[model samples]
Target: MDLAWVRQHVRQAAAELGFGLVDQTKLVTAASELARNTLVHGGGGQVESTVLQNGLARGLRLTFTDEGPGIPDIERALSDGYTSGGGLGLGLGGARRLVHEFSLDSRPGAGTAVTVICWVAGPPRQRKEMR
Candidate 1:
């Protein structure tokens, strides 16, 4: 999948969900980094984004999946300043910090799948009655 296109799609989705500018930027940045990792490290993969609602709260969830050489040490991978691709090593960790929920699944030869969710705090907004 194209990195830029993925980022654009994620940003647009966040905006459509009424995410504030800062929240939108955070989600976009995280999506961009993860998407690039999926392409460069995982030899290309798939990204899925969806809207989530829990009680009064709403959120956006993104999932990245790839069938490449999977991570052998998930903990080490999540550590700051640790990278296999000579990057700043902030993609996974940073992305985790930017969202409310984060999950990663991988094995040495199986593959990798990362899911993230960003939810708006407080109760859900009240809808107005139609005239």
Candidate 2:
């Protein structure tokens, strides 16, 4: 997966959801890290974005999935300094910290999927209703 494309897509979604610059940066940064993990560790994956709403709240949700040797130990993977690959081992944990909501599912012989959401506090922008 192209990390740049993932970042851009996340930034666009955040902006559309009325997330400020800080929130946009957070979302993009998290997306970049996850996308990289999806490629290097998960053996490549696809990302999907969605505009979310909860009453007056607005948010952007990003989901990354890959069909590869899934994480053997999810708890260790989410630890701050653990890695299956060569790196600082902060991708999953750091990405989780940057978003309002985060979830992960992995089947050792199947694949892995990570989902994250960043929200804009307060009311949403005045626009057509999201479907």
Candidate 3:
């Protein structure tokens, strides 16, 4: 997967989708982390963006999937400062903090998938009544 393309498309999509300026930055950073994980650890994956309604609220979901050496220990991997190859090890954990919802799936020999959702937080606006 082309990381640059994913980053660019994510930023553009977030803006066009009505995410606030500050929220968009968070989402973009999350996207970058996930993309980097896929490329560096998962041997590359595909990203999908979807628009959905959640209890009258609008949200965006991003799913990243890859077929590569999966996580051996999810709990440890998520623990702060834990790294297999000796690094800062903040990508997955940090990405989770930057969004509304975060989830991960992986198997030792299978692959890994990460899903993140960012909800547009605002008071629900009442729809105009038809005349």
The total of clashing pairs for model 3 equals 0
Model 3, residue 74: C-alpha shift (Å): 0.7
lDDT of 3: 0.82
lDDT of 1 at 57: 73
TM for every model, in the order presented, reads 0.87, 0.86, 0.83
List candidate 1 stretches off by more than 4 Å. 86-89, 121-131
Candidate 2 residue runs with Cα over 4 Å from true position? 85-89, 123-131
Best by lDDT: 1
lDDT of 3 at 105: 97
Native-to-model Cα distance after best TM-score fit, residue 45 in candidate 2, in Å: 1.3
Cand. 1 TM to true fold:
0.87
Candidate 3 C-alpha lDDT tens digits along 1-131: 48778888887777766777788889888898788888889888889999867665677899999998999999877777665562335567878889999999999989999999988755433445798
Query: Model 2, 50-110: lDDT tens per residue?
Result: 8888888888888999998998999988988766666435668888998989999998979
Q: Which ten contiguous residues of candidate 2 have the minimum total lDDT?
A: 82-91
